[model samples]
Target: MTTAGLSWFTVDAVGAAAPPDTGPLLLDLGDFGSDRTELVGAKAANLARASYAGLPVLPGFVVTTHAAARVRRGEQLPEQALRTRWKQLSGNGTRALIVRSSSVAEDSATSSMAGRFDSVLDVRGWDGFLDAVRQVVGSADAVGSDAPIAVLVQPMSTAQLGGVLFGLDPLTGDRRRLFASVVAGLPEEIVSGAATGTSVVLSRGLGRALETVGPQVPGLTAGLRYRLAALARRTRSVFGSPQDMEWLVDADGVLRLLQSRPVTAAAVPPRHSRPLGTAPIAETFPDALSTLERDLWQRPLDEGIRAALELSGAASRAVLSRPLVHSFGGRLAVDLAAIGAAPGPRRSWLDLIDPRTGLRKLRAAWRIGRLRTAYPMLVEDLVDQVDEQ
Candidate 1:
């Protein structure tokens, strides 16, 4: 039973539905051409747009907000629609998928809403997929925004490296340059800001960018970095504005564009205040310190930072608390008001940090002369640390 005025795009296995029009609910990522912000939300719409543009996006389906709107009104989803899509994914059920929130409010020109929603990753099987979708949809309702929530399901990228890219540098606001933060595995860790990643800036020409701060992304070749920069340049050109995007570089070195949003640039902050460990002493440290966590004043600064990371369940808390770290010039996240009081650093991680410059950075963070007194709230932990010595 197909309806007039709307051509439904359904995949293999799941057939058509009943007399009562449930509306064309599901859309394949590739089939999206016109803007469907009302249905798929901003992030999904952009992904769909890119997919339709012949970019190398993961094969996926968009669960339109129409289903969500029905759920909102206490109405039932068209069972036929759900089952067909389920078979498309779960029939053979070999590939694990990712279920991410796609909210209307996300990725607007005004707000990136980067970590505000929920995403269930590495989901396998039909039951798991359904649960993940419900979880994401429930997350949207709990979030309570004017925008309805939709879900995007795609095969998870086992990318050897992943993270974020800014079509233009947020620090210098240079359209000719591109900025990126890269992680060894999934982009989630870096994007959510719990851990920093290797930082790269591709300049004009071959995109000659400085390491500026943070450890450089490992295994990410110069050729790949240049390609990513070139992709960002194309994205900006297509959108007619600067774009900040999430990306994945699979083990095969295939690149995938996850999401892109508009960005505005601003003046660079103080080196100590910057996210990358760029202070003079940091020059000799390993790349991990700058990318993931920079140490505080304590011995075994890595231990302290890890203690800090352990406190949070995942990236959400890290993203909120990392007043000390700043993602490069993509997001206008310059001010970090609470990093002064965050807990300990990780072990094995702090050894690389330079003691002198690190002290200076800590002194700046604590806003005090005596380094011992800086962590007043953490005084008890400090005492134990000293006793360990």
Candidate 2:
């Protein structure tokens, strides 16, 4: 079928005719070259390599940058013509398809415009499929410059459990740690950031999966890990920081690479030192009190106690600022002066007393101490002074 003098090539037509090399045009992942098909881009080249490596990739094709450019110049491919082509390509099967934006600038060694494009999933028929392909191709031209898209049509996998995995723990730059979140079904909902429920921590589970699959596939998991780690390492080496990666495991339990990008502000250093001691009393008073000083000290200790408690609270808040999903129902509360701030104090004249209104006095002391510890530098000098005196 032809739309406005441009012939719309169906998968069947391309398959039947088997267009010759036709100059030095890139054929697929196998034919990728830096010079010949720069427009095919890095992402397309990677997908091509993955397919060639005998990976369980869906059978589909790329709609070259050459075709994308034509569409950008107001030469619209008719939905009817595209539908006709799609029906021929899809054949007879209950298949859910995906149309992704494979731009040259997406997976580059340098900068990347990650998550800035559109991809449609679960498309069933030609009409919807063709429209989706065109939308992605067209989006390349809209306001974002001539961002040509290479459309990849892959058969969606029926997954029992799926989610995303990061090569390293984002919270702490701990390389030994691997973080993942598993949902009940296909990875789409999770990828789109719409999934709920607890995201499973994957260090132990992933370790087992890697140990089992690595030797069998030779370079399967190892290669993926190496490549992802290298990508992250190189990115951090260049920018002097770490990166965040996106990955998935299919229904057949084979891992697939989805995306990788630099993690913003993940490399920021900790602002203060961590809290000290365990028991509530120890936390409140790190040093033992002298009898003479204890009798003389009526409200000074309570004031210092309050300061320390406040510091601890502030520290907890700082740790929570970094992006992370804590296990649900985990308690993170800290009250450093709970014991000292109890009611009915002054049983003995020697007993240190704040003489404040109620339990509020004790709670206030605890918060102050927590905050002081939380911002170490801010109060460290003062602590030293008190210690010396």
Q: In model 1, where do residues sit more than 4 Å from their true spots?
A: 1-23, 32-34, 264-389
Tens digits of per-residue lDDT for model 2 on 1-389? 34323455433333674222122211334444412234555455555554555433445555566556555654444445344445544663357777777786765535556556778877887667767778877767664756556665556666645555555554444555455555556556766778752343234223423212111222234444444444344434433444444445566666555544444443321333122222544454445545554444424544455444344432223333332211112211223213232111113453335343335446666777776778778688888999999
> Which run of 10 residues does model 1 get worst, by summed lDDT?
329-338
Model 1 lDDT at residue 343: 19
Predictions in order: lDDT: 0.66, 0.49
Tens-digit lDDT string for candidate 1 (164-186): 88876666455566788888888
TM-score of 1: 0.62
RMSD of each: 15.3, 16.7
The list of candidate 2 runs beyond 4 A from truth reads 1-37, 52-56, 76-89, 92-94, 108-112, 200-389
lDDT of 2: 0.49
Against the true structure, whose lDDT is highest? 1
